[model samples]
Target: MSGLLCYCRGGFEPELAAELGERAAAAGHAGYAVTERGSGFVRFLTPAGDAAGLSRALPWRSLVFARQKLRLLADLDAVDTRDRIAPVLAALQAGAVDGTLAPRFGALLVEHPDSDEARPLAGLARALGNALRPALRKAGLLAAKDDPRRPRLHVCLLAGDHLLLALGDPADSAPWPMGVPRLRLHPDAPSRSALKLEEAFLTLLDDGERARLLRPGMTAADLGAAPGGWTWVLQRAGLQVSSVDNGPLRQHVLDGGGVEHLREDGFRWQPPRPLDWMVCDMVEQPRRVASRMATWFREGWCRQAVFNLKLPMKKRWLETSLCLDIFGREAGLPLELRARQLYHDREEITVLAIPTGR
Candidate 1:
């Protein structure tokens, strides 16, 4: 069926499904979501058979739950084991002729869904991708070499013989496969949680903004910075940091003298003056943390902020929407806010907020 196929974190299919349904309707597309619990994916089927139009209506970065989004081309089931590549090639050729898909693609990504049930297919995906490259190039469907500027073709394996063919536009979709960035923790980092902030900078901000805003010598504050994981990231980025928490930090983090640890409660502490950035990862209720974050912006304490909201609630999407609404309205300013459930995050979402004029 013609629809938008979205990949999300395992066990979050319901949230993603609900988001797709509401978003598609809001974008003036009539569609119903089809998903299985813990399946790690959702399909929003449109009877109008306008998957392309719907995909265009919903931009990838606008989505909170989805890791990757693709326009459905065909769903091939029960394929013969002897020749798995033939059907995919056929689908590509047909779609190209019908104007449903691009005649040429920049890249081909063969990926499995992100779920325990689908993990075993990783090897098969890798093998099939290697096997398909030559045939696709010979058929003139795939480029001889990878091109980052063109659209990508996706072959997502629902099962060994059950394949979902889709197309991804580079301009609108995640650059990484499965929408998960592969980042390694720095050995000098005080804790593994530092990766969360690193990923936030990469995922939340564009290249130009990163270059313009996060220059060396910028000042920042890290609330709840015990053990100094987030504080270390700010320091590594060449920012002098004020680490606020009522606990001790690693001695090495202090050795550089870039970080100043304060023995104070995160919620109670305030920057003495305006700063370039403020980050918090305190374990608190989503609304309380959001309201506190709004205080920072409303009071003109910081120009930009990146924080996390702990979401152990049953209705996560509702909570996410409510908390974001509260943050925006309470801040009482024209702020650009972006949030995502990063791969490193568990039971939480990371948010970045900056004033529009900044």
Candidate 2:
């Protein structure tokens, strides 16, 4: 059986590919890139041990993340295309599907001209709801029977006629207290490029994951936090934040509690004490950021970190590998790390790392 893997552009695909490459080189199994387009599809001839490791590393949470791409459309036609398609469509029409796709994600794709109309593509999206509805109801991915809670689910439609739908996954899970807050990027208007990106990022975060990453009473330091996007997230999470930037921050963020604006160079500024979290969204070269992160991690200046490394326009994969190597070797700290090019992000990759000792 062939195992399918989907990867987001700036996420861990390169690392995953590198891992797969090593496995293939060692005669674990043959691995190849099956399809590459907006998203990527990789196929691996499953080796017992290697497959197990992959399964362990890929938690359901990661599967739900925008960077990791969903693993769906697995050999749907392997046995009998018609046989598989029929049941899925029937389920959709019946509204028996569960999870976020009960309404069906990627149903929009069927409306596009490129897809074959004769293939019952429309029915397939509906079937996802039909087929998974029971499971979702049971697992609480949907509303509980007579439970007055309304939760918003976030769905990611991946490549290969597959879907990755998640409901209330903590990061994007909803029914926020005041309803989801509308963030205004421009002081005068409700819409701006940065605000839109923030909303998109929050939607991808899900409530639970957001809570974990952004906890109350935590102390955070933001490097290169001018105009404060990442800092805004941390402050809203109820963490005390010291924002380091020579540039100005949004007035609202500046007025927020648990927040202190420091007008200093990010690279040169140092926190008075170790912080719970350190976030950076600088525009400098990737190596410079990597070097600084390594120094902080090595010196135990921060317990956990989330930062972005801008990638060169060409040879993105190679560049990612190089940065990973620097962090792994130079940090001189045992670390648990995950990196991905988020949906709300462009031309750069986000890294979330936690020191192992902590």
Candidate 3:
């Protein structure tokens, strides 16, 4: 079997499947998604030898629901438990012989579906990594050392006996294992919501963009900053923040002398002057939130912004498309907008927006 394998949050299989199908078709690829409910992964099946083309056509950054995207090389089934490495090596060698893969891969990533049923396989994945890395090098299928500029080989264990061999482009795929970043809650963070923003920065922005954009002494405002989770993240980045919310904020967040707690409704409170950044995490209707965010860009209230859109339980894809349209059309500026359903997010997706052309 051959296609593209997409990793996503467990319960969002349907959404990821829908997105894959639509995006693939839009990219002029004829494919069908094969997945089950809560599978945590989706396989977009294409005709033989078409996976490579599809992978090039659909860039990873364009996928909102997919945590990682890999081009399926081969899907092995009914492998013996004791000799699982043989089938994987065989698949990679076969692809190399056929010119479907490189002679040597730069890196090997062994992963599993992010579901409760598959969680137990994590240990097996690690063991396989240790056992297979040498075998891969001995077989001349892996480079002497890891190289970030070359293709990344992936082994995804669907079950003890079922696995998929795939290739990931280091330039386009997520850099983390299982497409999840290892983020820990900080002790100084007022609430767990801080992790959401941290993950957004890591996932949405590249290293160069982060260094260029988040300089110290920048001005920012955190809408609905009660308990000051997002505010805490911004202040830590050395941005002086106005924490706008009617509710009380954590005293430490305000004690940094960099954060000023403003008792006002987030939607109604506008920055007194153009600020460097504006972020909103208010739990309002998605359209209302999108519209307000659009107004910020339209009126030049902030240069860049990161916000969240709480999706409804049903028709999330439809809602996401409609809300993004409202935001883009209403903003009335060329904006660099990137959004994702982050690992820390539950039913909502986070968005990062920046106005273009000064």
Error of 3 at 282 (Å): 0.8
Residue 202 C-alpha lDDT in model 3: 94
Model 2, 1-358: lDDT tens digits are 3333444433334444554455445543554544333333234334332433343344423332223322222232222333443434433344332212344231111111112231344455455445545544554344544233332332222322543322222222123311133454545321232443355346434566566666799898989887777777777668899989988888877777678999999988888899888888888889878888888888878888888888887666677768877987889988867665554456877777775533
Model 3 segments beyond 4 Å from truth? 96-101
In candidate 1, stretches whose alpha carbon ends up further than 4 angstroms from where it belongs are 96-101
- Taking the tens digit of each residue's C-alpha lDDT, what string does model 1 give over 136-249? 999998888999887898899999999998888898888888879999998998999999999999998889899988988999999999999999999988999999999999
Question: CA lDDT, every prediction?
Answer: 0.90, 0.54, 0.89
The C-alpha local distance difference test score for the whole of candidate 1 amounts to 0.90
How many clashing pairs per prediction, in order? 0, 28, 0
Can you rank all candidates by lDDT, best first? 1, 3, 2
Error of 2 at 354 (Å): 1.1
TM-score winner between candidates 1 and 2:
1
Specify the poorest-scoring 10-residue window by lDDT in model 3: 94-103
Quote the positional error of residue 132 for candidate 1 in Å: 0.4
Candidate 2 weakest lDDT stretch, 10 residues: 106-115
lDDT of 3 by residue, 1-31 (tens): 4688999998898888888888889988888
